[model samples]
Target chain A: MKLKELAHSRTGDKGNISNVSLIVYHLEDYERLRQAVTAERVKNHFKDIVKGEVIRYELPKMGAMNFVMQEALGGGVTRSLSLDRHGKSLSSYLLEMEISLES
Target chain B: MKAIRIGGGAGYAGDRIEPALDLMEKGNLDYIIFECLAERTIALAQKEKQKNPSKGYNPLLEYRMEKVLPLCVSKGCKVITNMGAANPVGAARAVKEMALKMGLQNLKIAAVTGDDVFLNIEQYLDSTIMETGKPLRERYPDIISANAYIGAEGIARALKEGAHIIITGRASDPSLTVAPLIHEFGWEWTDYERLGQATAAGHLLECGAQVTGGYFAEPGYKDVPELWNAGFPISEFSENGDFTVSKLDEAGGLISKATVKEQLLYEIHDPENYLTPDVVADFSQATVEEISANNIIIKGISGKQKSSYYKTSVGYQDGYIVEAEISYGGSGCMNRARLAEEIVRKRIAYTDLSYEELQTDFIGTSSLYGEQTSTNLIPEVRLRVAARCEERKEAMAIGQEVEALYTNGPAGGGGVRVHVEEVISIASILIPEANVRVDVVFEEL
Candidate 1:
């Protein structure tokens, strides 16, 4: 799977918290990943789980991707455990998704 | 709108006073903290304490503080530091000279002391031992410098006294800023949760943005930018002990989980029982995130109980050491370096002299050529021999004998430059928490 396609497949579950970011090791591969995974495709990946919109942000220098999956969880921060106890659940939730480099 | 609380650049290792000053000038910072101590510094402090009661202070600290304190006063930015190596009084006095130079009258400089145990060494050593719960035997005062690592309250007191620069003795590195939080917010010391948060914040930045990719940085060293002049870390602790770690600007440096993770492991082995004079912080209880550019928000640094003892740094005159580099110039010049090490090792071993640390390195002849006297003929090799012994007499004896190797040994060595033998002691001291205290006093020049 292409790294970008892999990124798309992994970010499917996050609902409205559409922005998914990655710290990529390879520079050219990051560019390829960015080019393959467009904002619409990223939103489409999370279409089933997300309730609202999906926005993607890129930090080109650091090879990082930020995905804003809207309504990813049930409610906003007040109703969520996003900031509690070092955000372990969030890290765990994020860790579950896997991505592979493009052939 | 709330009063703007922005000022001072962070993580400045060298004498680069511009970044922090520029930030203070532009951002209007409320505080400026500087860290400039390393492993060798402790040894230097021990040397000073031997010379005078207030000799633990670093002269560089005074030079730096002299520059910053006046600026802080002019801009109302308070300063705190652990520059009080041995003599807080002397450190304060040095700053007072700076204040006088700046013509800043009414510089209320509050000096925090009493952390030193040099005078009371015999008393503590005789009274009790933590391990055996008995008196330290014979109490042969081998101590060079003994000081308790103090917290930030003393700086808080000095701040309260309206002193601009709070010079302290050996203090928890984080306590420099933590005291300010407590003082400004009127937070109690027993506010363990908040204190823990503050301490963790200090730890994260105490080494100046090691948490944000200054040291122990992963990935390629190329991408890390502005590292030559990287900014220090500034933390904002909330009432609930939740804080954000950020630098002065959107400077380039990694602040992701990896960067934060590496820093979290620095000087910390047990996440559960991270000890400081102020509090024992649990890194496990906290979560970290690369929230934004050059910003790492550290949350939920929780600890149920505070620590019982403050980690103390004590040093004594371990001994003297000398090093001499002699070139192997004779027929077997190439092999002389190797021959020299073996000769020194044999002599010391034969004499049954116990040295603390001794090492010999062969220079000029590249080891890339492979170890042992390379048959790939080289012009000459420099046998650089260095050794440290517990006793000066013993170290000197060993030094006197190394020169004899050329005459007695198998040959090919000459041009020996015997470096001067100076009095050096391996100084180490640690004082318990109960003994050390910190106080800050602001004085006018």
Candidate 2:
């Protein structure tokens, strides 16, 4: 199964850093999300775009996790040569990450 | 027992004004905040100010004020905005003049200034830029604008002085909401806990409709009804710091736990230490509950003392960005687009265009993800070529190469479009709060 089945996400950018928040549809799925979506996994998932380190912050009460990817916007929006300078589409790309449902 | 209703009006410089008008007319709000300044908006406005002395503020200031002021005057609701961009005093004067013309009397408009620190930028040349990890002196010559993110103090002062309309430049977005709350509730600057909660409310409301289903529509997965006419957010905040995020009853959007939770973490990196000029708000423990239809209460937010330094945004003239796009459709479109991309790349290399960076993207297949993810044959694809070059003439070659492909290279290539724009890139630096002297100048009509 894909992560999109269990959660939805939103992408926000500040300079070259892009932060994508993944929130579970149900609170019970939060623990499974935390176990599956590791910072290493996220960094590896966006290895093509992100050049710097990836830091993840967990909010168990809110059933969400925020992944902060540095050097992700190709040197920020104002200077980036990419079509989507802000990398707003990154959230959807993150949602496409495959998640193993057999646990 | 006292609570103030604050409406988030305009989110950005180009945000729609109708929803704000709807809020003013129907929401019955005490204060309406139009948070318009973006990271690079002030820098662009500074360039506009270089050409015209009195035209540095938001272009829609008059258009918005003309509609909002009359309603505010009649309804007795105050207005707050960072629409001033690069010129708060000029913006205030313009609003005063417009109010006079509209026969609106007894209006006290305040313009908060001193955010622009370009004249004294030399003093901070030795400081290290937060983003690039280099001294500001490296980009000193190219620096076009430098403005500190001023806090809620100046805005609260303006509100306390009974300024019906307040205009500011580069004030932190959340401070727009926090300022009014401080004035009405008389919250102390040292009250980090309340300030944190208020800042959370401001952050949720800062993006206008983002909290009210504007950005969260995924059809069957996460469906938001009437998103086209989504109402702007309104916060019914109390003195104790907790607030309820709601919209007008007749407005077209849902205020559910999901919408509120998504917005809570938007653009936030460290949930525990979300820094603003006013306070370092902590939203890590924040939770949302839907008590009624269109009303979600947010709680468990706190804050720490603010940092001694203010985060400043420095805009510099980076270079020129040239972008060109040509679409190919019908049979064999993918191959034609790929061939067009290759041709443009070879043409730029052959012409020896001096550029800092360049990229080619097939819009349908690999523009966003940078690789072909799907195996299905694409019927139509757009070839986009973009480059950043030091010289304007050099930047134009990238677009020219793409345009040439319409006749010279690709079959079925159509809708060729080219754009050349100057890049005003932004860098961040920290300035001592003492150096940024904020003052509010009031103009009466």
Candidate 3:
């Protein structure tokens, strides 16, 4: 399954950090999913948009990973959490990455 | 088969050695486990590893081991720990050297690695996306760390090999205990229900005495004895998948339903679906009641079939970051931080500068938002703002703007302390067990 569909939504703060708490039915698949995506690769993929710093944290036990795309959130404390003027969540945008591995 | 005995240990850092040692001594336990990783702690470990790869793995772990391992070795006990950070092999070698120094050459120590999948990061990025079935490069690039949180089986293998000490880099918290059980019981991988119960026991004791009144202790704190040093949780598992959670007698902490409940809730999501490599355990069927002082028996935990994946805890060197705490003074002490955040945001917008992340904090201020829709008070707020970005220049720009806000904003320059920034882009990855395999070999002293 895709991260967006599994996690529902994601949130990225000014630090280029994105967090999505999710549930995976099969516990065995946790590690495979993690190996498929990496923080550096995630940052490099968005190197243009996420020009500052990029970090990722994984809670394998919980089957979750958090990506911190530093400075990607428009100076952080001043910008809005909403995706647009209509206050749409940015989780969908963040989950747009089509990544998979041998899970 | 004989009942399996397991204990889980965790501390604020690595200073809780006395109680840990005491518990081993008093309980005459078979296995002792410890967990010592947080986000910041991982970052710190990574830095230390970069400087001296041999000197990471939570500094306190080596010190504590130096103090207790000899005694543990003399008593013919085994220890399994995740103290092996970026340098599991290095840490294991250190222990071997320590053993040599003590003239105890029979220490048959083993270190389990290969779970760190960082080497395969490029492969992952270059692979296809699961949902869209598109090439990964078509979407994202540059992943940080990719590691597998191997199950207890690796540690169990070390135990089976007759190693008195085992060091691993990132195994599940509950896996510590499950490893011993798997080693002892000769359980099959497909026996998910049995492994699930073992995992539950480890989870209960993973936080040490936290399940026994460390963090969640209340008014009974004064009455509790041996406050100076407390005992971690140990379990006695039977072949039937039943286990009792308890601590050594005369130890400082108290084990009861309240304490166990607190630790159960620690780092958990749905109680109904507590996930593990072996099986998904449902805490709903479990009950914690005080069997005696510093002891709570865990009963009736049902387990389901195992999952297909092993959780991966991969970390990578994304870039460097600097943190500075700017104090806001007087009525708007918090506002000063907020205003600084605003200024930095505006400045970054104007510049081509970008940061991986930046974080700011108002040290002494309110941390909560109003619970109700409209609750009124002359609220005193302190903004603890921080951000992480990839571009060091952007981070510097954000830092400069935050500092500049103090010159013209409320309570100008009351106090500011810039915390050192380091490479903070270690990320976690999840992979299927079928994809990554565990390899173990015996090493002589």
Q: Which number leads on TM-score?
A: 2
The C-alpha RMSD of each candidate to the native structure, in angstroms, is: 15.1, 1.0, 11.6
Models sorted by lDDT, best on top:
2, 3, 1
* Per-model TM-score on C-alpha atoms: 0.67, 0.99, 0.71
DockQ of candidate 3, scored on C-alphas against the true complex (2 decimals): 0.03
Q: Which regions of candidate 3 are displaced past 4 Å?
A: A1-103, B11-15, B38-56, B126-141, B218-228, B317-322, B329-383, B405-407, B426-429
Separate DockQ for every predicted complex: 0.02, 0.83, 0.03
Candidate 1: segments with Cα more than 4 A from true spot: A1-103, B1-19, B37-43, B46-56, B126-139, B217-222, B250-256, B324-336, B349-384, B390-442
lDDT of 3 by residue, A49-103 (tens): 4455655555444445555454454322222121221112333444555656445
- Greater lDDT among 1 and 3 belongs to 3
lDDT of 3 at A89: 32
Query: Residue by residue across A14-97, what tens digits does model 2's lDDT show?
Result: 999999999999999999889999999999999889999999999988999999999999999889989899898999999999
Model 1, span B1-445: residue lDDT tens: 1221323244433445655665555545677676554434554676766677656686677557656766777788777666766667787877887778777766677787766666676655554432223444332465555566667767777778777777776666777767777787787777777777777777666666565556533234324666666655556566556666666664545555545544554444345566777677766656666678766677767554556665444444445656766777656675666777788888889989887666565666532111322354666667766666666678667776678876876565677666534432222234555665444544566
Output the number of the lDDT-best candidate: 2
Expressed as tens digits, the lDDT of each residue in B355-402 for candidate 2 is: 888888888888898883644487778888888999999988788888
Candidate rank order under DockQ: 2, 3, 1
Name the top DockQ candidate. Answer: 2
Q: Hey, what RMSD does candidate 2 come out at?
A: 1.0
